[model samples]
Target: MNASVLPYREESLCFGPESRLIATLTLPGDHPDSALPAALTGSAELPPPHPHLHQASRTSAHPAAAGRAPQRRPPGLILLNAGMLPRIGPHRLNVELARTAAAQGVSAIRFDLPGLGDSGFTSSRLSHDEQTRAAIEDAMTLLSRTKHAPDRFLIAGLCSGADAGFQMARDDSRIVGLYMMEPYYFPNRFSNMFRTLRRLREYGMRRSVIRILQKSRFTRRHDPAADSAPVPQAAPEEGVRAAPTPQHFAEDLRSLLGRGVQIKLIYANTLMGHWDMRHHHRHIFSKLGHAPHFDVELVPHTDHVFTRVEARRHLIRGMAAWLRRIETQQHASAA
Candidate 1:
């Protein structure tokens, strides 16, 4: 029997001052002339811009544009480095995702930030945070040129990468959608209670008690908790940052939603507790799903990086499906 195959064209991208920044661009293989994507064919109609989304006059820092129909060009996808991981991402999830997207007629790029992977730091004297954003901006410029001016693009990231994507989306109008894995989880009293009860149900009192103690000890020793990313210099990939207070995180999310960004937040049961947005956030919003622009998903038995094959497959499928849905909705809105 022959092995199954997926088609794509992959190339290395080296940009920025001294060309120190490195990235991989994965473009879809040749499409049948008869079945080119709408972006290529110039068939998608541009919808009227949302007044609240972006002003025609000025540019500044803020989340992505309001949920506006994308331009004639299909949205380019930027797969950010997961935490300090290189472009390959945890378990090569970024590679797999880029391939999947290429097969679906989307272009995807995975790159490393300065001090991570093969990418060297820029010569600029900007602060660390400022440099990171500047590097990303350079990537957008280069990627836009390669893809020939995509009207907008999507940013998908995990952990620290998720944070980078979120910040850039807020500042750049070209970012139209975000897929964040294990992003900013703020548990409340009810969520804490639910977790305790869930632990009891799963392990029973005796084992659950032992497990809790063991986990506490484990966290103290190795400390993989979401809030505490180890600070050792050698292990860059282990880095992560805790989000700001729940109030601020909530406000950020709402602002992005109002701007018409389509956000998909996925939480996993890694060391970071099984936090579902429904449990942690439903109380905050009148009805969590009432917002049409965003959705939250909770996945079980998946580690933070999705090491397990089936778990990772599920994650990829959900992402691809969400991307398709967003495009479909944009087309519908334009119609």
Candidate 2:
């Protein structure tokens, strides 16, 4: 295929302090942006953050900045590293999602924070969580400089990555969307019942059936792929918080909703481990009656790490669909 006709183009980048952080930038091709609504692809424009920075980004030396006039940042997403996993994500899930987002006319960047993947550790005094927040802000700044992309941003993360994104969203107004996969879920009165159903009936019976089949030599041995995704790393050493109190969570979430921020909680399974259950947010949103901007999803029968191909497919599709919905609404409201 010709260089210009490719569905999308990806370029490696070294940005942040001393230009040491590693990141990959993916931008949509001409045809890729055609299908997405103008809202999702960025329609209205505003002036760039800085006149000098705007001029620098328009220089032809950078592919992302090249060929576009200085304008307000377009809509984009920041794909954070899953815990300490590289920016590519487990099984390169981040790469797949970035390409998918590109196909819809949005740009995406997957970057390594200090000490993860190819990025080196920092000597800063800030704690890890604080560093993560700063790194995310730096990513947005990088986009503003490199691609003019960051007016309204989205973040996709899993586990610890999800937690960090959640904490950052509370303080960062630029963040307009968040995908928190297996984010922390505080338990409620229904927690024990859900655990019983998941453990004895859901898990125990399946194991029993498998054991019976193996004893009778009637079925092939069942083996699952190894999942190397982060396993609940220790709580944030300082600064950033892991989980907020239920009251604080409800308050903060309501505030985000008031600001039109979209939230999607993607769980690995229905009522899986960690005292969580489907419809777990009733206590939080009960008085609100109906909040159009909030929702929950469960990738049924998947493990915590989402090793299953089908699970990841479901996640990517859900993300794309949600992005379209939220962006369309945002654009309509802005109009």
Highest TM-score against the true fold, candidate: 2
TM-score of 2: 0.73
- Error of model 1, residue 14, in angstroms: 0.5
lDDT of 2 by residue, 1-335 (tens): 23444455677766665565788877665553434543344332322222233222212232345687554444788898887689999988899888878767677888999888998877788877777887887777766554434566888898888887888899989888888888876767777876666566755887856755777834755444424544565644533536777777778778888887889888876564433543455556554446788887767878777899999998889878987887677667766
Q: Residue 126, candidate 1: how far off, in angstroms?
A: 1.3
TM-score of each: 0.72, 0.73
Candidate 1 worst ten-residue window by lDDT: 49-58
The backbone clash count of each candidate, in order, is 5, 0
lDDT of each: 0.71, 0.72
Q: In candidate 1, what are the lDDT values of residues 182-221, reduced to their tens digit?
A: 7876666677677678678878999987877877855565
User: How many steric overlaps does candidate 2 have?
Assistant: 0
List runs of model 1 lying over 4 Å from the truth: 1-6, 33-71, 189-240, 271-279, 283-289
Badly placed stretches (over 4 Å) of model 2 are: 1-4, 31-73, 188-241, 270-275
Error of 1 at 259 (Å): 1.2
Which one is best on lDDT? 2
The TM-score, computed over Cα atoms with residue i paired to residue i, of candidate 1 is: 0.72
